[model samples]
Target: MNPLTAKRIAATGSAALKLLMPGLCFVVSSLAAAPVSEVAEQFDRHFEQQLVEHHIPGGVYAVIEGNQIVRVRGVGVRARGGDEPVDPYTVFRIASVSKTFAAGLAAVLAEQGYFSWNDPVVNYVPDFSFRSARYNKALQVEHLLAQTTGVIPNAYDNMIEANVLPDRILPHFRQLDPMCTPGECYGYQNVLFSLIEPIVQQTTQKDYATLMQELIFDPLQMATASVGMEPFMNSANKAMPHVRARGGWYQSTVVPSYYRFAPAAGVNASAMDLSHWVMAQLGHYPEVMPEHLLATITDKRVRTVRDLRRGHWRQFIRDAHYALGWRVYQFGDEELVYHGGWVRGFRADVAYSRDRQVGLVILLNAESNIVSELSTYFWSKVFDAIHIAEAEQFSELHSTEDD
Candidate 1:
């Protein structure tokens, strides 16, 4: 083996090798089994190579299989030209992945009779109004989570990026025209989507952050997960945001203002925390991610403009649609729940297969399109492994019957 590969194997220890080597043997066995450790190692090597090739400053990733965290690894330094190494506990802005948390909280509240999905926004926020009376009247609680409010995509994201307060951005909607009737078309919104926070606060009589902590974070035991910018900035183990320039990657000095629009784009978490979140999504923690609630949130509500065929993994994706705070893709005969986020110089992507109970979450402290490519590559590996495992199991079953 190459020196680097030998060193890595040694550093990971005999346990990882024991798990991985046997798993490789299963791949060649009559009953092929793709163990979690083997799949995780493949992703680890791929991610490491990508980080070097793309000059990424820092990245943290987690893989979950069969409702268990299989791997958590970090590559590169926390900041460009710095010595701090990132790890599983290295905090990062999850950006719009916060929307998933918002949707979950809302779904939980709905289960408790706090509000119906179809409840009009006006009922929760009396002051809420759209420029078009038709849309204003038709808007429902679900529209915000579904990204079907008919507002222009990323409307006022620039303002949020400019460090404007979310309270000031809400009034701008009154001057904007709706592209379509509510729930009729997909029009992604950041500022408008965050309205869920106020609605939750009004109904639950608790702050949005507190509601998230009590309902989701605490139950999942996501110790490093936190809302808003303060906690993230104050974290000693957090990755510093970086931007690429002509010379090399440089640290960003801009304050993360997206936390002001907490429900839409503000969330900070480590790979370890997100691994538990992924497990919950896969129905491991039903007490928190109840079956009915998961069904409601993941239901395909509207078609998005995403064209899966343009990517290299086009042959794997059959169709794509928008669910509550997630993008649902038809992969073979199963559903792939996915979401990607970007804020300042940070980026994140998360996806899972409910049927297979396999998922991945990746957090990066650098700005690049590589995050999307990485997700596609990771999903391809997962699906390929599942296909092999299933085919081998079928062959084994038939042979046993014949014997």
Candidate 2:
């Protein structure tokens, strides 16, 4: 067979295998690989039950298939005891998922020859300095996106939680210590990403927020996505974040940081809006972005710690690596690209397998370590159901031949 024909055959087989395998349990009986709508409904019900059982205030999800959003679902109340309902347009703070967008922005400018990934940080931020002189020379834009910046645990964690003004934190970032030589270990550090914020400003001659709005958000048509905290709070369709206390769910009423850092964790979006975000990852719209740039950002560069599931998760999650702004995970000989976001009382998870041409996105208002575990469980079951249903249907058809 021709090489191109063999590649096509391999991709089709992988997707068919995904549908034929029974996913993690905890789904409705009607769900089968028979139809996409049935699998979507099963996922909706599975998440609804998870919300009430785990005391999650609310959540939303979208499933994308072959460049289109095939299903979007919301469950529970946005706030416990509140009348607000989670919906397609309801926006939530996506925490670190913002990194993916920032990295994408950097890739765009880099492709335009504005700067290369290996460009020294000090090259742009002329005054840039780190704790050690050797570290200063080693730091590069790739270090920021790859989580290789020798910085210790997030430099501005306190300032971010305290809602400190950005101007206060931006100038003093040179005080943090290096954890390892750059490009040696993948210790996640947000302050390292702070470096990219300045580079984007210097290169584009615009703040990272404006650059993102012009380059990514507007182009993707993610109308509801933004990096502003106050505007999100005042929005009519935004979800109220909740936290579980000793007795029940309580509203989290803390003020947000005044300034935005597009490089790290500062994005707010809806499930519907994020579905399109995943579509962009699959190289669906070449006009908005060059195919090569998207491919560069999603390429696997470094391995991760472990998989994020239970009961056979170890087998399914591997070939993990940190790409530009996303985590690439491989399962059962197929690859999936995804990112998870968490800030305070909000959580978001988005994943899509390039091989299968199918993806899922989940957002929740309340924090529970179990929330992600449960969401993964639910989706895995969906994957399994699709496969089992296909097998059963196939068997039934074959049975007629034997008769």
Tens-digit lDDT track of model 1 for 148-260:
98888989888987888877877888887778888899988888899899899999899999998899999999998899888887899999988878867789974867888
Clashing pairs in 2: 19-387, 20-387, 21-387, 22-384, 23-381, 23-384, 23-385, 24-380, 24-381
Model 2 residue runs over 4 Å out of place are 1-36, 153-156, 164-177, 306-315, 378-403
Number of residue pairs clashing in candidate 1, backbone atoms closer than 3 angstroms, sequence gap of 3 or more or interchain: 0
Each model's C-alpha lDDT? 0.80, 0.71
Question: Which residue segments of model 1 deviate by more than 4 Å?
Answer: 1-33, 307-315, 385-403
For model 2, how does the per-residue alpha-carbon lDDT over 1-403 read when each residue is reduced to its tens digit?
A: 3343356446554323332234331111222333445667787777777777887888888888768888898887777788878899999888788888878889988988788999888888777676566677788888889877756656777776677766677566567657778777676766567678888778878877788888888988899988767658777898877777887778897356523554677788999888888888777867666789878888776666644343334435535678888887655445667777777788888887665567788898877665556545545554442222344555564455334
By lDDT, who's the top model here?
1
Q: How accurate is candidate 2 locally (lDDT)?
A: 0.71
Q: TM-scores of all models?
A: 0.85, 0.82
For model 1, the local distance difference test gives 0.80
